[model samples]
Target: MEAPALEVVGLGKSFGSVRAVDDLSFRVEPGRVTGFLGPNGSGKTTTLRMLLGLVRPSDGRALVGGHAYAEHPVPGALVGAALEATGFHPGRTGAAHLAAYAPQVGVGRERCREVLEQVGLTAAADRKVGGYSLGMRQHLGLATALLADPPALVLDEPANGLDPEGIVWLRGFLRHLAAQGRTVLVSSHVLGEVQHTVDDVVVIARGSLVHASSLSELAATAGARTYVETPTPERLAELCAERGWTCAPTGAGHEVPDVPAAEVGAAAYAAGLELHQLATRGADLEDVFLRLTGAAA
Candidate 1:
């Protein structure tokens, strides 16, 4: 069967006087990894909870497979979710935890073994979850989510505690899942953190949707800039200012933003400034994200 799209339509939630999520909307389609990004306390978790039916939304609808999570007859088999990684009994072995929840997912112990191996936790299968590192715990949570072989996945901070090697593994693993036509939505507090992992991005701030677009689209709209090093920095900055370009201070030199490298180079050469080094800086996803979500402030 084809994977179903995950949709949030004007979703909102209020906790008495405070609103957690406000009129948010976006879609996650199959065969792509979508990064759900926002700063901490920006209602990312609340929005996800509503979609998973863990929390009720006061205002709109969160749908999986064209139905609310509660409406699905077998939601687990349709959308696998690993919301958090610490929900395990301290004394229970990883394998044992899987065994305990296997019935709830309508899968037996054998399926548990398969998912354990799939998430690279086979060797640590017998180890107590208490002894598992945060990265291992993350893999365990993912293994549990995969137990039912769901077509779409919703993971919150799957890469949060991973080390360098573990992060590389997760990036490849998520891409593989999407390659298999699964709709994958992974949440994080920063866009640059998941910049290379996702095909699309949906960003929110203060409980409201701020930006939603394909990864490439976001990059294209970010407006690449030119970074240049010069001995006469003041002159270059003045030149950039004259041309209406914003020259941000950088470690090596100044970053003339929103202007092409060729244009900057011509202007510098025309002004008789000796260029020590010049390079084009690609779109900085984190910078763009901060500006969009107002987190930079």
Candidate 2:
């Protein structure tokens, strides 16, 4: 198997008396979208900053292409990162901003145009960044990251402030990049957006790694229980109790644990109970995330 495009080992960071990240470790493989997810102040941004060499880690290491980012001969060629979309000069045009980084990263003017087009920003390439909308700035930031044609990408909240159309475009764009044998690590607080986009996920909370696994595996690990919605929910609960199944009341329904959908249907029918809805509840990524992070859903 190929080596991971990016590897974080026992990474940690502290600010004053507070620990921002605690022994966080994960790997981003090529040709896959790895989601770096956490709630507010969960150290997701701090961790990405350390990986891109923007912030010095208090302990441990973040490696890109098997070497520390600072030690890489051509860091820009190996990794592309966008920590903040608006962290550019207000006076400079979008094209000018990219031109400045191009020479430093050994990327040519033609490559800049290609990336601008790739990110759907070629039409506004000459506009001053200060006048651009939030969505446009995000596109410009993405264009800048791709200027070097790097094999791996580290983006922090790339979809922030984007409209629904822009968000949809970004989803397809990131998937395309990953499909081309590149590793894409995206950090986002929007769990619903990343749930369908990422192949693997790393969830953190309170400066600690909570869970890391493939999307399907994480969902399965959360368990495969069935939810039964019935007009007579109390009767269903009684049936579950008689069968030694764990059942909890949720709103008008009963969340039956360790029971299959077929069994729930059979039980309801045998008990002469009328079920409004009976279906197997597939555990979503958000459910698993909240459970692991000890957060309310």
Q: Please report the candidate that would top lDDT against the real structure.
A: 1
210-292: candidate 1 lDDT, tens digit per residue: 88999998888889889999988999878987888898889979898888899999988898989998899999878888889
Candidate 2 overall lDDT versus native: 0.84
TM-score of each: 0.95, 0.90
Off by over 4 Å in 2: 1-4, 240-258, 295-297
Model 1 lDDT vs. the true structure? 0.90
For model 1, name the residue pairs that clash.
Answer: none
Model 1 quality (TM-score) = 0.95
Per-residue lDDT tens digits for candidate 2, residues 138-194, read 888888888888888888899998898888888898899898889999998767777
Span of 10 residues, lowest total lDDT, candidate 2 = 288-297
